[model samples]
Target: MHNRYSLKEMFFEHLTRFSAILVLFFLSAIFIVLIIKAYPAIHHFGFSFITEQKWAPNFELFGGLPAIYGSFISTLIAMLFAIPVAIGIAIFLSEIAPKSLKSPIGVSIELLAAIPSVVYGMWGLFYLAPFMRDVFGGNGLGLFTAGLILAIMILPFISAITRDALNTTPKILKESAYALGATQWDVIKDIMIPYAKAGIVGSVILALGRAFGETMAVTFVMGNAHQIPSSIFEPATSIPSTLANEFSEVDSELYLSSLYLLALILFIISFIIIAFAKFYFLKNRVKRKKRLV
Candidate 1:
């Protein structure tokens, strides 16, 4: 029996190690491919590939400034709208919901994440765009509309992760706070949030990552205009949206390479954001541990 248990443990350990290695292998492969494919545009356009604002492919000029600007603005708008609502929902679900209602509510929230991106795009294009047009004007397909759709799409992800983080708070800490005559809000604001700060930050970063890379929904409602948006109501294009719209139609090698370079830029941006989040989380965690000690 002892020998069998040892063999079983060894098998599982090797399996897990292999899985981790496989993931690293795939990531390295993708990074290498992006560097190779994007080299032409990077070499030809140099720094201007990212700095220049015009994307006149007919004249063999391509610039990612507008797409990058659109991506940042749209993500900012989405986070502005999403963060408060997501936090509220997370707080309610984790701390306030009755036992009988919690399961159903959680499931419903998660169901939003399960919906296909294309379905969200279709709904945004057909329903939300018209509503926006009538109420806020500008043909409705623009940065604001895209941001709204992205907010809705990322809401479930942020809320679910936040709720999970909140749920992990120690029960004894809450009980002690309650015994000290602290109100529910005080407990949540002081104990729960601080204890789960790292996880909450992680959730927000994950949501931001999702918002940044989102393609289909943003494409459908973003109007695909390859120019910097002067206003939230003006048409714009994001990096993902640009790639989705033009990847198939490009006839020039430079244009194709430029698109790959855009993809590489996006990958680098995401990697940097994730790395920052991880560093921040670790630093805070260490500080908290020292405080506890």
Candidate 2:
């Protein structure tokens, strides 16, 4: 019964939908291409490629287990360090920060994320590596240093998102908590954290994805060793770093394909993690709505 959109408005709306479909199709096409190119490695190594850790060029043997493990462990360490700090920052920004201090501080934290990845790597190499060596009393490059750098890189991401998530909490919820005689800490620990848990987790997943895929920062600090690390202080390699270091020199087609397969694996891992995060977000959103009702 209302006035319909003009011809240009209708055309623009359809264009937007079609553009989104095209973007999805393009992404699918790229995935297919990468898989096809990587088929040789998958066929040659079978599933053992994922499990076997040795990556020797002399015997023409290769596997990504070590690299994958490094990526996982480094990112996990980053999470252990980043999550608490990011949460603290978020909590302060959302509830405890003075009105005058909030904007400047938030902007500064986000500016950290805006720094170039290469710049982070260079700093990791020159500045962070030396600091780690001085503090930890060992070699400059190791899983720990890589992880520390990754944490610095991922912190801003999680903190910014978490702050936004917490800020989005309904004012009525805070009022209700106050009416119930809940202390500020109690309200935050119970009402606030639980309500924003889903979004915080989504932010974490995104940060973890960045950690797993990070190349320059990790590579500069990881010592670029392909062997399995015995401790967090030991030098190691990650899948992305391995590819970045060696893909250009992979003389054989099988070697090249194997590298591409590693990319595929990373892509799949990220997709699954993000999907889980999305599931958590949607589940919590429903739960939050029900609680309101």
Candidate 3:
């Protein structure tokens, strides 16, 4: 026997396909436009554009190394500070917190995520920056400050998603483990985490992509210096910070093209990281599910 779709089903299916194709088309168009805008700098600098450190616009010199380095270092610091704390918060909310305390804490976390990025930037500039400067003895508007702001900005997203993931654990499984003399920690470590690994990983990857592309928050506190910072507390710049700080001041074609190149680089890095997580982890998860079946 052959199966046939109704008219509405076919129309909806085709519409969905068209929507997916439209998204791909827009992404390709954006990449093509960036390449076209960045071609001059690509031709002028060749591979050296990525390695050279100088960024003087007056001399027509431009390099992306410092910006790239700052982006990497700041994101690294953010993940270092954020991941453990986010996980702890998730665990507390999911398994440890009393029912009386959960809703208020959960709402507070959602409120943190609700605040604007620019507001986080301003708060970092006025409050966190000075506090850190007093404690660490530096200007405090650098990679470290930018990284902390990013950590705070991303914390709510990671914790909320992770808590939801943990909550998906089957009650039967947890009860059985408890009956078998498993402690709460053991059940959490051995069951809930393994069961919700995919969602947890996806949430972390989502936060990571955000950290890489975050603009206003980093721009306000990253110091926007074009040179490599010798210390984490010294001035630095990331691709987004640099683009925001100088995109309007371009008096030369090379300078503008170089900025476009920086944007393209940021886009490519975020795309690759997200694609890897989506493809690799999802495929492995599917295989694991099949095995269980």
Off-target runs (Cα >4 Å) in candidate 2 are 1-18, 286-293
What's each prediction's TM-score? 0.89, 0.90, 0.92
The digit string of per-residue lDDT tens for model 2 on 84-178 reads 99999999998999999999999999998999888999999999899888988778798899988899898898999999988877889988999
Count the clashes in each prediction: 0, 0, 0
Overall local distance difference test of candidate 3 = 0.93
Question: 1 or 2, which is superior by TM-score?
Answer: 2
Candidate 3, residue 41: lDDT? 96
The CA lDDT at 45 in model 2 is 99
How many residue pairs clash in model 3? 0
- Candidate 3 residues 1-293, lDDT tens each? 12345777888999999999999999999999999999999999989999999999989999999999999999999999999999999999999999999999998998889889999999999999999899887888899999999999999999999999899899999999999999999999999999888888888988898999999999999888988988999889999999999999889999999999999999999998889768756887788889999
Candidate 2, run of 10 with poorest lDDT: 1-10
Candidate 3, superposed: residue stretches over 4 Å from native: 1-20
Model 3, position 193: C-alpha lDDT score: 96
The models' CA-based lDDT, in order, is 0.92, 0.89, 0.93
TM-score of 1: 0.89
What C-alpha lDDT, on a 0 to 100 scale, does residue 179 get in candidate 2? Answer: 98
Q: Which ten residues in a row have the lowest lDDT in candidate 1?
A: 272-281
